[model samples]
Target: MDPFAPPPFGAPADLGEPDPRDRPARLAVGVVGAGRVGTALGEALDRAGHRVVAASAVSEQSRRRAAERLPDAALTSPQEVVAAADLVLLTVPDDALAELAGGLVATGADVAGKLVAHTSGRYGTAVLNPLTRAGGLPLALHPVMTFTGRPDDTGRLSGVSFGVTAPDPLRPVAEALVLEMGGEPVWIAEDRRALYHAALAGGANHLVTLVVEAMDLLRAAGVGEPGRMLGPLLGASLDNALRLGLDGLTGPVARGDAGTVADHVAELARVSPEGLRAYVALARLTADRALAAGLLKPEDAERLLEVLAD
Candidate 1:
């Protein structure tokens, strides 16, 4: 079978994911905020055979991005974007989403019977209450991937998980849209949206901080190419952690080596006083996990706890 061949409509593919051909009929897509995410999704949908009719871009950077990704889409105001498309993507920041929706309604945007989807991870369909009240179909479809507005951003959408939350009757529509965009839909309840977003932020966002701190330390220790050195080690550690959870831990804290951990704490305090607090906190959490997982003996954990406390 040709990997790129289109799947038969209404038939499950080899991976059992939703078939891309099973999506709704082609519709005119509109992007309300032509930021990195908005343009990327718009481009992906365009690749899936939907027409990008119009896009709203306030900043020069956003306008440039929309030009590159949705070249055929007319640059217009937010109200005009909503008025021209069958599906409107609200890609604004999380805090500004509700206000944007309210403003669109107040400005007399024609949203009735249109599919209004927001790309906010923190919110569900509830944030689009204004649009819904105006007879719009609301969908909360958040792609679980970072976007830098580069040419590669749209390509990254393939097979990425989308946190989807919609009314029970609209679940299929929500999932179908994700499938069309080359994303897998993971159904998220409205109440669990915050928790789901928090988990992603804690893991992916905090991991960046931790890795950058490690690079800074490596440079201080005279390593010229920190990324080259950390690349393999971090890659393996991430793989192990994903495959084994707590069992993948192998550092001094996981091994209950209080002396080594104490040395680390002392060195951090002396060399990088600002990083000492985060080190201590993460070390304590690691030790607790190791102990609970039975990887560290009770006697050994007591020494580790004392060092952490100090």
Candidate 2:
């Protein structure tokens, strides 16, 4: 499975002309590091009617997988991939991005006049400096969604918001790229990239941690299938929260039930002492939200905070 090889999948659909906002030139797209994110994004662009001219992967396995999924796309070296495409997506890991960009520059992969982008949330256009200095317009366009290794991963990309950051001149192009992928584009300042990424991580990554902790507690409480027991409740609560916003909040804290809060704290301390800290932290945060929502009076919030703090 050479990561650099094009997938044996059927020919990709024709990506229409360059995004209408883009210069009338049809930009050749090159995907570097054909891993899950790269492959998924490539497929998405293909579906959007963009030309995915070439793709490269660091491993032979990835190359083969890429070949199977993007049979019409060329399998080549990272440098060659960039050279062949007018737009280059460096979807490699965060730590490896700088090295890969530097490698491409060292190999004289003239990135000048190219639209260079990466899917890293942790880095902004700075990581693409090597390419930018060589005349490329560097941009950071990260999709706020998860990707697995499946070829159909592109489906998850639809309707997702992409955090886009690029220079003034490149902003329109960056936004157009997001639209081309059927995603909403939100422009973020380069300096605020960390803050933007942190917010996403807090909601997505930490939510997963909170759910896992809840499941562990449930299992310890004699639940044979924690997920089955928690899934419906979690899903309904999430849906309600999204639909009704803060007004959808309910539960002991929202009702200012001090006794219930104390009981939860005591139970967490007894079952999972480490988890108690998280419970306390989240409760305190929720108390503030409840107060802001006018669901909890100031006094009630104070009382709840007292109980949560302990």
Candidate 3:
């Protein structure tokens, strides 16, 4: 069946998930926000053979993404998308998700019995209670990959984990969708959803900030190609850290080289006070963890702690 052509509306409801072989024709998907994430996912679902019927884009970038990634999907309002979809993906920002769902409810839209999912990492199904209370089936499906608002992003979804939170009866539905998108589904308890999201953000987002800060400092220190200079070191550090946990730590802190660490602190203090603060704080924490991991001796760490505190 052509996805642009809607499935006949009178099909009987099947609360259970559709079989993998029948999913493409059995469900009609809609996107409530045609931003980077929304378009990429719509493309993924479309690639998995699901029919993307419509999507809503409020900005030029979103509109362009929708045009590129979801060309056949009608550029329609959220209400229209909700009306036509058997499964509606609310992919707006975290701050706007609740309000958007509330708007859909307030408008008395026909969301009843439809599978409604949101791509908010910080929130679980609770943020979608407004929809569920109105008879919509709620599921939280936060993709654990970043989006670049590019057409090629759909390919990157393969093999990444998707943090899923749904009711027991709907677990299969959530997992099946993630699998359809070429992702692993990790069930996240609703209460621990925030922590799950925080771990991802700290690892991904904060890591990016840290790398950029290092690059800035390197450029200031007369390095012409900061990225080239740090790429191998950062990559090896990340690989070792993941493979060996805290035991993978290397550097002055891990070796408890107080003199070298104090030299770093003094140089950073002279050149960049902000960088010095960050260096000291991180080195202190690294030393603490190192000692606990038996990588640093008490006598060796004592002098390092004094330098870090100074």
Candidate 4:
């Protein structure tokens, strides 16, 4: 068994990378959860020439998704998947990863010598300690993209960032694998995994919540098409914020319009108290960032802070 040789049988076809890195030899991969992320990643790895031997899909929806996304791979149990594969992709929930790994190890699965990876954003290689202790090579591959379990979801994985956390010895192997998956590897330290994941959740997940809340408020205020109203404004805002960061901060908050801010707070308080609290919290944070960015003067922010505090 040559280390650099591709999987002899039961592997998918070969592929290329975005950044023109070398596509490493394919491994016998097994996905231990056929959820959205798991199925998509398994497909992507298959496209990268890896042999997806089997996948674990419990729910009906998951089984269907696995059949769709991982058609080449057989459906089976987690322990079987772990045992059969050279690389095991454990794409379970964050909370379930440890227990799953422990259970597999306890059941005398051959975790040792396998590249045991999990697609958990909140954790790094640390969460795969059970596998590691069992002599498995731990890899944390977190794609910083949302999934819909649709047909085209796998195509979107190209040219994206993957928060990769692997041991120093396995760094090249992990990164090469990421490149083969058509993603750039953003090395995340074991210690900073939580913060790294937090930042992503704060930006992506919280942005979704904020946008939905805004739309709800718009609907509450008798706006017929909340999406239409917010579409362009949010598009530009997001573009600017991505390009300019705090310099992109705008609205009454950035301008330090205390009375206007007060009016917003009062209106939200009257109409939607939930929106009011969020508005206040975000506005204060925006104002603070604006001041720090030198976009807002001390004297200008004083009244705004006073109104926000009130």
Candidate 5:
């Protein structure tokens, strides 16, 4: 099976035997922040037989998203939403999560005995200590897919991997909720959540920058429809990297062609000086990986590294 291939739509995640800590099959769910992630997950939960009873939406855009995707859920205040549901999803921005949890507790919200989960890849359950102190069962469930808040957002939930962090007693509950939403739960330890999120950002977020830069360079060189030219190449490169790791590397740096790499650096610096730094940095890293992977000999890597440094 290709690791890059998405799972079949509606495929069930293998959760093995059910555990005692698992909640009832149907839950009254509330969303504390009706952002893209919140509404999408709320809709997915509704499709999974859960009742989306309430959701808090401050912005007009968020309120519209909640109305469109989570039609059954009433738009209310965060405190009211928490008070009305068995499970509450706090899908605020990463920086806002701790404050939201803390504020919920500060306002004397009825979080006691309720399952409260936040969708922040950079955080673990520890960030919800404020709510935990108030007797709320805190869990972190960060979905590994990007959300655009479009109608198709709910479909993206199918077969997605959710980074989950929960206490031992609530592990079953976390996995069950992920499975119910058609996502595979990948358990992440508390101490490693930040690193895990960083890896994701480095890959997905930076790939966009790299691709856009490439497209810009191509357009500058008078290549019309840059996407058409890059689509197959990028697709194959991604698949190769997934399958072969560093051994999949190609191009001048990977082959230790110092002259070609030097020419690339010279041309970019001449025409697109702003992108020169990133190109050099990535080339240096690629040369290191290729050298370590035995794809480039030490003699060739020495020359390659010299070109990048220059």
Candidate 6:
């Protein structure tokens, strides 16, 4: 049960020349759900010299995709994929993962001696309970990167952080797989999986919402090309926030400009009522953060809050 020890399930028999990271011999890898994540990870592992034993997708579109990514890998049902490979990656939609696990276990697909992992960020090892009960090691290793349905997704695998959650018996294998995929592994407790996913959603998904709202505002103001004007500023602001921490925050909220805040809310209410609530909510949150950062005095923060609340 040593967290750093490799699992007994997927160890290769020959133990040939060690990989660059001195990992245990490459395991036969199988991928289920040949969507973007599955295809990308399969191709990256294949490129890293792992044996891609099998890959399967529920639809013809997914099968074609897996074929394009790993032409030599067998295409079969999910149960076949699980039975054929030493390590099975369930990359199906989060909602479908539990059912898939149950199906794999019901079919008696050698779960007892396999390493089972999933790309779902929401549920941890618990979603693979059927596999776990059958003695398969369950791991959640979600890559913190966006996936586009393109053959070149392998490139995006490099330099990403993978949120890894697994039992102590399976941690090393999960970490090694992350390394094999050119990603750094960040260990997370299984119980915190939902909270971790929520954080990611708030940051990545809501950032898109904020940007789209900005674009809409710009368009309403008659800007012909808002993206061109906003791109550099957005990039620089992100860079500064990352490098300088909270001290890098700028804008009316950071400056505690209550008048400007009121003006923005008023303008949005008049011109874009649909965006008003989001703008106010986000502004209030930013104001609180600004207050905590010492960028806004208490009185100014209070006034800004009042303006945003209105």
Report, for all candidates in order, the number of backbone clashes.
0, 23, 0, 0, 0, 0
Residue-wise C-alpha lDDT for candidate 4, range 1-310, written one tens digit per residue: 4322222232224344442113455577899989999988888887776768899988999999998878878898888898789899999989998899889988988876778889999999887787788888889999999998888888889999999998887887788878878899999999999999999999999999999998998998899999999999999999998998878878888887899999998898889897788888988888888999889989879999999899
TM-score of 2: 0.85
Please, what are the lDDT tens digits per residue for candidate 5 over residues 47-159? 76677999999899999999998888889999999998989999999999889999999999988778999999999999999888888888899999998878998899899
Of 4 and 6, the candidate ahead on TM-score is: 4
Q: Per-residue error at 141 for model 5, in Å? A: 0.4
Q: Give candidate 3 regions above 4 Å deviation.
A: 1-25
Better of 3 and 5 by lDDT: 5
Q: Which stretches of candidate 5 lie over 4 Å from their true place?
A: 1-25
Q: What C-alpha RMSD separates each model from the true structure?
A: 6.2, 6.6, 5.7, 4.1, 7.1, 3.6
- The TM-score of predicted model 5 comes to 0.92
Q: lDDT per model, in order? A: 0.88, 0.82, 0.86, 0.85, 0.88, 0.84
Poorly placed runs, candidate 6 (over 4 Å): 1-25
Q: TM-score, each model?
A: 0.92, 0.85, 0.91, 0.92, 0.92, 0.91
| 144: Cα error in model 6, Å | 0.4
Q: List, residue by residue over 1-310, the lDDT tens digit for candidate 6.
A: 5322443433333346555213456677899888999999988877666778898887878888888888878998888888888788899898998899898878878877678889999988889988888878788999999898786688998999999999876777788788878899999888899999999989899899889989989998999999999999999999998899888889998888999888988899998898899888878888888888788899999999988766
Tell me the lDDT of model 4 at 147. 94
Q: What clash pairs does model 6 have?
A: none
In angstroms, the error of model 6 at 182 is: 0.5
Clash pairs, model 3 backbone:
none
Candidate 2 lDDT tens digits, 274-293: 99998898889889988987
Identify the superior model by TM-score, candidate 3 or candidate 4: 4
Residues 85-156 of candidate 1: C-alpha lDDT, one tens digit per residue: 988999999999999999999999888878899999999999999888887888999999999878999899
